[model samples]
Target chain A: MCTYATVHADMDGSAKGPGSEWFHVTAATVYFDHPVHAMAEHTLNIDLADAAKGPNGRVALELRADSARALIKAIQDALDSVPEELRV
Target chain B: MSEQLTARTIQITGANGDEIQAYLATPDETDEPGPRGAVLVIHHMPGYDRASKEIVRRFAELGYDAICPNLYWREAPGAAPDDAAAVARAQGGVPDERLLGDAAGAIAYLRALPTSNGKVGVIGYCSGGRQSVLVACNLDVDAAVDCYGAFVTGTPPEGSLRTNLVDQLPNLRAPLLGMFGKDDKYPSPEHVAELDDILTANGKPHDFHSYDDAGHAFFSVDRPSYRVAAANDGWAKIAAFYGEHLATTASTPTGA
Candidate 1:
């Protein structure tokens, strides 16, 4: 089934994208839906994109649901390890 | 039967007179000697990718001229299928009205073909499956096939903009052939039963089949969900249904 459920977030950052070039990333679109390449029936997909750069200017990830949750925890743990003054 | 066919990407006018890219396939003129019926193959939510194009070609191989419009063309023209799909999904998917317009345009293109026998059908997979039924309800198609499309009779998951077509069932103009996987949760057995009851109550012509061992997207050969037994049977059913509804008459010269 196509869930048709999506969430979006605006961001200011940089990431390496297509053609091995770095681009300013301004948005992230996330959804759990049928993956284009993942072998699973469904996966949590994330697109870190620069909409201004068009569709191809982005890094995409499709992870298993459990993997996505683990990633979230890892990210939180890493951020928590930083000194409070250095966090910003 | 000749296996020879021709296929290519072409341009067609879509919603609001916008020119969109489409893939078209047709049997060789010499192989099938008559005005042929046409089919509008709606791509799934994944956008117009290689698999969708393959389905279009499969219809042509089965003797029907087929076309699949690029529903994501407006957002990501010339972009990769996955990229276009991502863009379209983030943009809240295609609007119902716009999809209708694109479908109508594709139908018109098929009917206008010199070898057309004045019959057109629609078949869609996944999200496209629901759209196929929607198109049949709103358009003048001769036949419709819904392959495990959800939300046709059940509530969509929360936050989904999709709505059930209960109110529109009476307006369905074509005979429908629905194929489902018994294990599919979206069009669960209950949902399929509800749809069957509604169509039956409305005196609509429909035939539905559910495979016990199959689940959602059983027809997707490229995906892990693909179930060979179910897919094979489903294709046979489609062939028979279209034969009954969209079969052409005796041979006729182009432009006759």
Candidate 2:
């Protein structure tokens, strides 16, 4: 069944998408629901998209729940490892 | 029995008079000139993709003119199915009023076909399932088939765009046929029972079949949830139900 649960947020980033090309992503849509290509029935699906560039400017990910949580922590850890002055 | 059919993408007037994309399937013209009923096949939340188009073709094989409107067209016109679906999902999904207008438009398109018999039905899976029931309550369709649709009875999770249809079932205008998996929790057995009770109390006609050893999306061949026994039987049930309610008749569209 589709969970129909979504969390939308405005963001700024660049991610590689189809054709191995990279584009600036302006928003993120996150949800835990049935995956399009993931082997699992349900996963933590996220879409990083640039609405101005249309639907093609999207980088999608479908990770297992635990893996997604680990990724969140890893991102935080990577940022923490960098000095504040260098990050700025 | 599967038969020779032709499928194609076409543009039709959709909700708000928007020219939206749609997939249409029609069978080979037979020697006999008998009229036939038509069907509107609503694609699931995943958008209008191959699997849903196959179902549209299957309806043609079953001797009905069928069409599945691309609900994501406004968001991602000409984009791949998965990509379009992703865009629609991020945009908060299709609005209910738009969905109803699209359905009504599809029905009108089908009835205008030369072979139409003025009877039209609707069948939808998953999220489309709930939309199917919703349209039946608000439209004058001949029959409605809801396959494992969630939120028709159960409360949608808070913050979700979906909602239960308990308030609309009383206004259902057509005979309803529902297929479910015993293991589906969204519209679990309890939810199904509650829907049955409500429909019965409202004096609405309905038939529901729940299969054991099956869960959500049991008919989705591409998904792991597909159950051969359940899907096969469910298909048979749908054919019979449509045959009875959407039987061909010598009449014209009242546009109802």
Q: Name the top TM-score candidate.
A: 1
Provide i-RMS per model in Å.
1.1, 1.1
Show model 2 residue runs off by greater than 4 Å.
A84-88, B249-256
Model 2 agreement with the true structure over B129-204: per-residue lDDT tens digits: 9999999999879999999899999888797766789998989999999999999987798988999999999999
lDDT score for residue A73 of model 2: 100
What TM-score quantifies how close candidate 1 is to the native fold?
Answer: 0.97
Clashes of 1: 0
| DockQ values per model | 0.81, 0.72
Score every model by TM-score: 0.97, 0.95
Candidate 1's DockQ is 0.81
Local lDDT at A85 for model 2: 88
| Most accurate candidate by lDDT | 1
